[model samples]
Structures are given as C-alpha cells and as structure tokens.
Target chain A: MSERSLIASASQTIGPFYAFALTTNTALGVMAQSGAIGERIELVVHVVDGESQSVADAMVELWQADASGKYQHPEDMQARNPDPAFSGFGRLGTNAEGEAAFTTVKPGRVAGPDGGLQAPHINVIVFARGVLLHLYTRIYFAGDPANKLDSVLAQVPEERRSTLLAYPDRKRRELWRFEIRLCGEGETVFFDW
Target chain B: MHSYKRTLPGTQPNRRHDAYRSTLLRNPRQPLIQIPQTLSELTGPLCGDNPIGESDNDLTCHFAEEPLGQRIHLSGRVLDEDGRPVRNTLVEIWQANAAGRYNHPVDQHPAPLDPNFIGSGRAMTDDEGEYRFVTIRPGSYPWGNHYNAWRPAHIHFSLFGPSLLTRLITQMYFPGDPLFDFDPIMQSIPDEDARRRLISRFDLETTVPERALGFKWDIVLRGSGATPFEDAGK
Candidate 1:
C-alpha cells in the first residue's frame, strides 16, 4: 500500500493512548543543525532476538537524565535544572525493520540519585512481545566511570553489566550505534522491574 | 429493514437473489477522499505529565453513581481486506468510571469514583468480527490544566490484531459531548476533520433512550503493504 494508505489504515485503529513521535534525527529538531557540538552521536536501537537479529515494529520509550540529571516530566520526582525544552522522555515505534535511530548530542554529566556524579549517558528501554510478559529493558552507554559508581548499575552483578552498555563506535566519528537484542541466545541481562 | 436498502455503486443488484452478497462484495472503494470533517474542533493534550503514576489529588473521577442501572451494552466488529471479518482478535477497553475516575492506583486526584464502573473489560471478535461488552457511561471530570475544563465521555481502546505491527490504540467519544471542544488530547491530533473520525455515531433505534445510547464504531487495520521489519535480519 502507498504510505498514505498505510497511514490511513493504521490511524483508523490506533487507540488514543498511543502517541507516535520520531526518534530519528528529527527529534533533535534545530539542536541537530547546530554545528558547534563535536561528532554527532547516532544511536541505533534495534529490537531483535537474543542473537542480535532485528525485531521491527517494537515500541521503545527512552527517558534519560538531562545535562543536569533532571527530567522535564511533571512527576513527583524533581530535577535540578529541568530544561523546559528538554522532556527527558522520548517515545518511538520501531520501523518495519526493527530499528529506531536517534541523532542526539551526547548527554552531559548529572548528579546521581545519591549525590555522586553520573557520567553523561542516554538511557534506553525496549518493549516487545516475545518478551511481552516483561515489557521493558534498560540499555546504557559503555566505558563511563559512573557505570561503576551509579547506584542502579552497581546493584547488578558485574558479569551482567555489559548487557546494559553499548559498544563504542569509532568509525562513524562519534556516532554510537546501540543494537538492542530483545531475545535469543545472547539476550541482554534485564533487570527486575 | 427494506426502507434501509441503498443502491449498489456498480451493476444494479438483482433484488430477487444474492442481494446480501452483492452488497457485501461491492467494490469497497471510495474515489472521493472525504478528508475528515467535524463541527467541534476541540483537541486534547498530546504529551505532558505522566498521569498514570501521578498522585491521588488529581486521581478522582467516577467515584460515585447509583449502582442500579442495567449494564450498558456495546457491540462492534473488526474488518479486514476484502471486507472479510477476522475472528479472535483481542479487544481491550478502558474508560473513566461513571464518576470519571479510572480504577488505577496511581491516580490520586480528588475526582469521584463509581463503585459500579469496572473501567476495564476484554473480548474477542467473533468470526464475523463482531464483539460485545457490558459497561456504563463514564462521567466527565475536571483537570488541573484547564479552566472549567472537562473531558468528553470517551473510552480508551487497545487492539492486538493477528499481526504485531497491526497493534492499535484509540479513543471513542460519544456524540453531542459538550466538553468535546475543551479536551486537549482530542485536539492534539494534527487535523481537525480527521479527529472527528474517532467519534462514535449514535443509534437511537437500538439504544434504550432512558437508559443509554447505542453507538456503532467500525475500526479498520492496515492489511496491505510489506509489514515493517520484514527485510531486516530477524
């Protein structure tokens, strides 16, 4: 079907709860156009089987600490410098190909829930069916020293910590691709919700 | 029923035989793209505070109602390509209680809660894509964001089609809701006319006038095109 027809058909059944937003470079809007930042970060989140195969059409919600470790959401929790411009919450559905990409500037250092400093990183949550019984998993950036001190990260067994961090990508300059493996043999270690 | 008969788009139907099939198999296509039209152009909130986990102060809606009325009956069908009915598709519905409060733990608002309003239900579409439910008319409640604001009487729907990408979430608003214009979520939709497509039409003949209005809503899911993620390594 044409894109128009597809959207028509899809929109017909979509309930009020589901809101579609672009997680691609478009989410950055003008911030992406600013050339001042060093190497643009390309985050590729693929919902796939345990073996790293793609699981398209999965819904992914990302909530991260802003530069000051504050979420822009109006929840009970508070942020130090909640940038009115930064929502800290991003929602996107994986394309038919099981991959969702976000072109965003790397997040800056923020205070951890405990008062210690947390390394600048993006937090990711992946939702899919095979893993339906469990709705989401957390994915983090690799090599940040804060990973060692972060309370949430420190709680997980060291052997399973790699499941949350993405491999460093040097070829695309600073573009980091985080392939989220939903299920299969090498399933990323998920936390107890 | 004879008075309800409408002519087919193409060949004149043989009124004597196969009239039903002819109507069913008509070229289910409309050349006229009726861009959605609506008299009330109200929109609702798109994104904001996560109301799901908010406090109790803002959670009260549908807290009171005389629990004596018969169950409100709602029935509908799910149609596929070629206008065939798909059976066993899971249908889920949630609405504000009669008092406009959802039976969720996170809601702490001062809205009333109807002990009678279950606020949630589930059913499977039959072979003919037909499904039915028993519920109550959810109440309209106030919100902190708007001045004298109220949400239209509506139900939140979630459908899990035979396929994964076919999953859909939508809302169904009743006709003649005075608060329809003041809702933020309804207004968030990009197009004003397209938004009306979400409202349900009233059927007075079947509805118990003194009781509740019968509304018919038919939802169409995407059936054609390469389902997304087919080419990727699965």
Candidate 2:
C-alpha cells in the first residue's frame, strides 16, 4: 500500500476466441444445488444485437440473493440468515443460437437503498467481444406483484420497463425466458452505479 | 470491502467505436440509467482467499510434458485508482497457445495448438495485491478485422474486486509488438499512455536463470477520486 500514484488500467475487448478458457467450467453456471430452497426456476436468456441477429459469443453472469433474501457475501450488511446452500453467483456463455440457461432459486425481496422492500430480481452483467465495457442490467419477474413498488424498476421509463421483465414460457410453468437487445428497438434497460 | 469510484471516460475505451466490426449492432445507443448501489451492487461473490488449485497459476505444467515456446513468469499487482491494494481478488486469464492457435472449436486458424498447453490460468491476489503465473508467450495471430491484420499477442484477464463496480475484464500485451499499429482493438484506446499500460514490461528480477523469463504488469481498477493527478502530461 504505497503512496505511489498509478492510473487504472484501461479495458480491452475479450475477443472472439476466449470461449475455451473463460468458459471452461460451466458448472459455475448452475446456482441451485440439489438441496437449495425457494422456488426452482429455469432461467434462460437469449441475446440479440441491433440487427435482430443472435450474438453467439456473449457471456452472461448472474448475482443475486438466496431464497431468503440473503446474499452469500460479507458485504451484505443485513444477511443475517444467509443461505449456506446458495452462493447466488453463476456464469455461462451463450451458445450458437445466442442462448444461455441456468437453474436457480428465485430470489426473495430485499431492502433497497431507502430501506424499503425491493422486488425479487437478479443482477446481470454481460461481456462479449466488441463490447468494450461490460453491460449492466437486471432481470425482474414479469407480472410479479412486487414490480408495482420496486425501487430500481421505478427509475426506468414506464415504456421501457417491460424490457426488464422475464416472461414465463408457454410449456414450462417454472421456466422463465428473457431477451436482451444490445441496441435498436426493445433494447434492454441497462443500469449504472 | 472498499468500493470503487470515479469514472474518467477519456481514460477508458469507447463502447461504440466502429473500427471493431462486432460493435456495430451490439453496442447500446441509449444512455445508461443511474441506479442506487444497494446490496446487489455493493456486494460480490465471497470466494475465499486463493480458491484456485495449487497448479492453477502455472499454465505450463498441466500436461506431463512441458508446453512448447518461450516459457515466461508473468506477475503483477492489483491496485485501485487511489493506489491502495486490492487484496484477495480473483484474477483469471486466457490466451492463445504459443502457436497462436486456441483450443476452442471455432478457431480455424492454421496455427498449431500445443497439446501440453491449455492457455488459461487463475489465481488470487495476496494481502498485498500481488499475483503471479507461469505461462508461455502467446504468438501473434491474424484476424478478420482488416486485410493482413494481425493481433498483438496478449493474454485476456478477468477480475472481480470486492464490489460489482470494481469488476473488470481486459488484456495484457508484450512490450514491443508490431501488430499494435494494425490491430483495431489495440488502437481503440484513444490515449497512447493508457494503451501502453496494457503492455507488460520485461522484469529481469522475476526471471528465472534457465527456467523462464519474467514480465510485470500492474492492473489499476476504478477507485475513489483523490487529489487530481499532478503528472498528467508526462
């Protein structure tokens, strides 16, 4: 911890050939172990570019609270009842069709910045070749009762709010499908700190 | 848990730079919305110190035989903009083999992939923010970016500092590479010095006599803004 000044290193694209190394262990993509609690859902994400074409090289990361609204992190000041079985972190790379899927328990309501209840949601970060900087966004359950009063969702425009929701697939009751558009119409709502 | 701070856009790469062909339709034209840094943004995975295996940092020792090409010792520190140590953070790296061929299925490059080398490694920074790895120098490879375009040999890096805002994924290059001039990705950074930071310097101190060469490159993540830099031009 010297007082020497150093500039933060700049970012570069991950390039097209990083899949073999970065995504070697796909087991990290599975969040819910056998005994994890809460509602089990299959989370599937499909990514598309402004050209309405699939982005096959993208990598998606998910971080969230366990079923009890407790994060498996030391920084979670109020996670007194953290779930030992839930790590709440997962990483997966998209396939040829620009799709990545995960099986995890749905998060519970957590306190917001104002100490109010927030909707159960998952924090998502996207990394891909040509994406100079990683993109930040969140996934909210479509038609959830908490969406009406969630703090973060309120920040997005009413019209674009639909972009954050994940609709239930027609055939599977516990399956949720989300679409992330990098640009053009119906672009996903990205957040910044 | 030290939080990240201060975003100086000029010092970073642009998201929508057009020289890179893939960014054309994948970059967002809409502005990012500001959000409160609550539990989600404030916290990250609580991976214990050095969760990686003992041999994980030594990419060259995976197979029974040694990997071909120049074996090098790559090491460095992880610091914040405030010059404070970012300790116990995970540092993951991936790169092309010595022959510039990847083990991936999609890489159609004619270069050969060393069976002994996997081209990826992981390590955790110590209490002093220092990390090290034993790997071979990756070779320069051609890409579809432009005619006769060759990318400077580089190792891809990924790290998750304490908080989500501190997370980063970047690259590390060799000292003097001719491809820097032609590669669109390396040219994407506007500032010359900032781009130069990506190039690791040859460090004789860390070099092994007959075992491996040594290179040093420090990664500075976004952190709280302090007194403005007095040495800007130099």
Candidate 3:
C-alpha cells in the first residue's frame, strides 16, 4: 500500500439531518418559570480526535440549572421554582469530523453548594468512541465579573479552571468562542464516575 | 499437483470409527450458524483527506494518497429475501498491503511496508448491497511469534445491516494461506470448518490475474437494528 492509499481512506460523511431535534427541542436553561431574563446566546463546540488531532465524530448533551437554579425533572424532590418552559436540557451530535454547534440561551444564576451563587452558563457533556466513557465539562462566559466569583469555577484548580470557560469577543458583543480538544496538547480536564 | 495426496477426515472405511459415527447418527443436528465473527467491510464514498467538498487544492498531507492505486471497477447489487435491492446500506473493508499492517492506529505488526498504505475504503450498497471500491492487493506480515504467528493476507469487513443493532462485522482471508493455521483471532471461532467460511474462494471468474484479484464477500447483519439513542432513558 502507498501513502496515497491511506490518505484516500481517511474520509467520512455526516448524515443529512441533525439527530437531537428528532426527540426534543427544549433548550437548556432558556428561562425561568415566570419568564424573567430569557436572553439567548450562541454556543459552539469543536470536537477533536485526540489521537490524530483530527475532528472526531461525536454526540453532545447539555443541561443546567435554570434562572432560579432549578431543574424541572419530576424526580427532583426539592420544592424549588420549576420552569415549565425551561427543561434545562438539550442534546446535539457532532458532524462526521467531530464538530457540534448549538444556538441556545445562557442560563441564569443559581445557588451553589456554598452560600455564594453562580453566573449564567451552560453545562456540556461529550461522547465519542475513543474515550472509555463519556467526557463531562462546562462552559462559562468570559468578561462576566461574576465568572471570577462563581464558586464552582473557583474550585477548579487555577490551570484547569480555565479549561471550563470560553473567551468573549468584545467587538461582537454577545458573541463568544470556545473549542474543546479531547486529547494531545491543552486537553480539557475530564471527570470520572 | 505437487506430488501430494490428501486424506479425508472421516472416510477411513473399516477403521474403528464407531464412537464418532454413533454420535453423529444420534445427534442429527447441524451446528454451522452458531459461531461469531468480526465485520470490517467498507461502504460510502472513496474518502480523501478533506470530506467537506471536492477541493482540487485540498491539502494532501504526508499520509494522504495523491493518486491512490488503480481502482478495480468491482460493482454488484445486493437483494433482500424479497429480491428487492437494499438501498442505503453501509459497506466497509480493511486489508493488509502486499505487506500487512492495517492503516489503523492499533495495528503495530511490522513487515516491509508501504508507509502510505491505508488499505481501507467504503461504498454504500445502492438500493441494493451493490457497491464498489478502488484498492490494491494487501501483503502478509509477521506477527513476531517465533513458535507460530502470521496472518494470511485478508480483508476485514463490516455491515451496518438495516438498523443500529443489526450491524455485522466479519473478515475475508485469501485462500491457500498457510498462516491460517496459526492466527489466534481465526482460531477463536471454535469450529474449524466454519472458520474456512471467512476465507474467500479463488474464483477464476472474478480474478483478472495481472490486472486485479477480485473477491466477492457478502454479509448479513443480525436484524434490523435500532436508531441512534435519543435521550437519557432511551
């Protein structure tokens, strides 16, 4: 076999329709029950193949606490303010080369383990074949002063804490960009069961 | 004929074949379909480095094939029980080079190798399992086991079947390869005769000698599989 043969073999394709919308359209952290700060933000995640540094095919799922820091899942026994409009969950699969994009609203603040509250953000979980299990991480908006104060963000060791957040483009206003690399250089921290 | 004669397994007439014959006569059951096999077929379009679109200036990396091997125009149609050509079925294939070393990250077995040989490709079974690919003859490689370890030149295949759960994975070995006697993955199947099913038959009708050696290996996935998981419970 020649190098040409190997190069010829490294191609793949993504299907026509995105898989998420097939089941649910509920956006994660889109609102509070009373419909308070329902501002929408664009979220983009780039999935990469750790071994080859190539984009990998993957599926992404996201969910989070609502404006009042609550989830509507029926199993939750805590008598919290449940937002019928905001289910606090959403799912998206990556393209053939491991690229997934989500256009969703930023979730508002909620109470943390400590008395201090946290900022509006989205929680992201990714699934690919290489990893033995699912990879879980979070995305925080840059430029938000509350980001520095968010208790969850503060707890992640300094170097690792940055991996869970994204930088904001000042000129673009609400626009923000975040890329998650699965392996190789600058790999995001992953948690285990 | 190389001055050789082969003996049949159970045809030694008056010899004491009592126990084996008695068991076979009592059992009367055929055990051919119970074994498991791996599927490594290829389907879909011939891939280039860039999957986005047809770009003439596409970056041909060190591992990319600039002009790939001469493609053998092998084409065929796959029909179901009802004789309908099954459309949209995925076909995949992987094989050794004239020297063996899968173009995969996990395969590390060494042999005089072609650095550019990826030896893998795919084509979708048209409204039938009908599909085609352009590839070259894979080579054999040494498994480094001194006592006995060498794999015959073969191709791995996989089929998506009709559904997610219905997928099937298998491999195709070239016949007349003495290494088949020592390959572990092959021996794992338990049934010696069934193991031969994985090796392709040397069909003179399909092989073009100097041009290309062609083999038709068809597969059936378990059953109509399920769709992609939708939510938590699902």
Off by over 4 Å in 1: A1-193, B1-71, B208-212, B226-234
Model 2: residues with Cα > 4 Å off, grouped in runs: A1-5, B1-3, B224-234
| Docking quality level of the chain pair in candidate 1 | incorrect
- Of all true interface contacts, what fraction is found in model 2? 0.80
Tens-digit lDDT track of model 3 for B35-107: 1111101111111111222221111222655323432334344443223345666565656555555554335
Query: What tens digits encode model 3's per-residue C-alpha lDDT throughout A1-193?
Result: 1111000010011111113212133443222234534555556676654443444445566656555555444323348765556545555656555556555556667545465666666656554432212345668877778988876666566776676677766786555667776654556654321
Model 1 lDDT, residue A105, Cα: 56
Encode model 1's per-residue lDDT on A1-193: one tens digit a residue: 1332212221322221222212333453222334423335656776665444466546565555445444443221442545554444455667668767665555555545456655565544444322211233445678766667766666666765676676667776565666665444444554321
Q: Candidates' TM-scores? A: 0.42, 0.94, 0.38
Comparing 1 and 3 on TM-score, the stronger one:
1
Candidate 1 residue B88 Cα shift, in angstroms, is 1.0
Q: Which candidate's TM-score is highest?
A: 2
DockQ for each numbered candidate? 0.04, 0.62, 0.02
lDDT of 1 at B84: 47
Report how far off residue A34 is in candidate 3 (Å). 15
Best by lDDT: 2
Shift of residue B95 alpha carbon in model 3, Å = 24
**Where in model 3 is the C-alpha error above 4 Å?**
A1-37, A51-54, A74-81, A169-171, B1-234
**Model 2: per-residue Cα lDDT over A22-85, one tens digit each:** 7767887789988889999999999999989999999999999999888877767772877767
Tens-digit per-residue lDDT, B1-234, candidate 2: 233465655667888887888877888889999987787888776455435899999998888999999999999999987777889888999999899988788889998878898888889899999999999999988888767878899999999887777788899999878888877787788888889889999999999998899999999987743434532422
- Candidate 2's displacement at residue A165, Å, is 0.7
